[model samples]
Each structure stands twice: as structure tokens, then as C-alpha cells.
Target: MTMILGFPLAPIRGVIKLGELLQEQVERELRDPAAVRRRLEEIEQARAAGRISAEEEAEAVNRVLRGMQT
Candidate 1:
């Protein structure tokens, strides 16, 4: 019966749905201006603290800006 076949796939379906939800949340946050600003600030702080190099900071900032565009 279909139930027998579907039972094994139920967990897979749930995992897929969870992944979709997480993706949606990430996209929503990326579109948030404040969230983007905070990320940029974090990158700057890291650079100032020497936790990241200037090149790394630039790359991180570019990535955050690109995420905003998307």
C-alpha cells in the first residue's frame, strides 16, 4: 500500500520542510537593514581588534552587502 511506502519517507519530508523554513528565515534576516548593519559593524570590530585582516574585513563587508542586494 501507499502508506507502507510513504512511512519511510515521512522523516525526509519533515527535514526538507525544516530546511525550507530555515532558508526563509535566513533570507528574511538578510533583507533586514539593522541586521545587515550589525553584521558590518561586527566585521569592523574584528578588523580593529586584529581578529581579521583588512582583506578579510573587506571580503566580509562585500559579502554582507551582496546579501542585502539579493
Candidate 2:
């Protein structure tokens, strides 16, 4: 029966649904102005601390900016 076949797939379905929810949350955060500003600030702090090179800082900044566009 359909129910019998679906029973075995319930866990897989649940996992997929969870993944989708997580992805949505991440995308929502990426588009948030406050979240983007915080991320940029973190990158700047890392650069100031010499934890990342200038090029690396530029790349990280670009990546964060690009994420906001999407």
C-alpha cells in the first residue's frame, strides 16, 4: 500500500525538509542588512588584527557584498 511504502521514506523526507528550512534561514540572514553589516565588521576586525591579508580581506568583503545581492 502507499502508506507502507511512504512509511520507510518518512525519515528521508523529514531530513530533506529540515535541510530546506535551514537553507531558507541562511538565505534570510544573508539578505538581512544588519547581518551583512556584522559580517563585514567581523572581516574588518580580522584584517585589523593581521589575521587576514589585505587581499583576503578584500575577497571576504566582496563575498559578503555579493551575498547581499543574491
Candidate 3:
């Protein structure tokens, strides 16, 4: 399985289904300015704390943004 920041890209049907559901949930629930801001803040903190590399943080932030698109 390929992992996109712990998000697994898998051949399993269940995983794919769950991914779809998660995407929908995020779109409906977390697709807002406040949600985006919080995600950004968390990413920045992780980067400053040396928990995740700059590149990893960028990828994660990009993914969250792309997911928010309608």
C-alpha cells in the first residue's frame, strides 16, 4: 500500500470505500475557513517542533486544500 501521510492507497475495497466516505465528510464538515486555518496552524506547529519535515508538511497542507475544493 502506498501511504499519503498515513492515508493508505490500497487495493482493498473497504479502504477505498472508507476513503470516499472520509472525503465526503470532510467536504461537508471541515470545508471552511476556520477548519483550513486550524489545519494550517497544526501543520506549522508540527514543522516548528521537528515532528514533520517541511516537504511533508507542504504535501499534507496541499492535500487538505485540494480536498476542500468543491
- How far residue 20's Cα lies from its native spot in candidate 3, in Å, is 12
C-alpha lDDT score of every prediction, in listed order? 0.95, 0.97, 0.83
Which parts of model 2 have CA positions greater than 4 angstroms off?
none
Off by over 4 Å in 1: 1-8
- Residues 1-70 of candidate 2 have per-residue lDDT tens digits of 9999899999999999999999999999999999999999999999999999999999999999999888
lDDT of 1 by residue, 1-70 (tens): 9999899999999999999999999999998999998999999999999999989999999999999888
**Candidate order by decreasing lDDT:** 2, 1, 3
Give candidates' CA RMSD values in order: 2.0, 1.4, 12.6
lDDT of 2 at 44: 96
Question: Against the correct fold, how does model 3 do in TM-score?
Answer: 0.59
Model 3: per-residue Cα lDDT at residue 15: 74
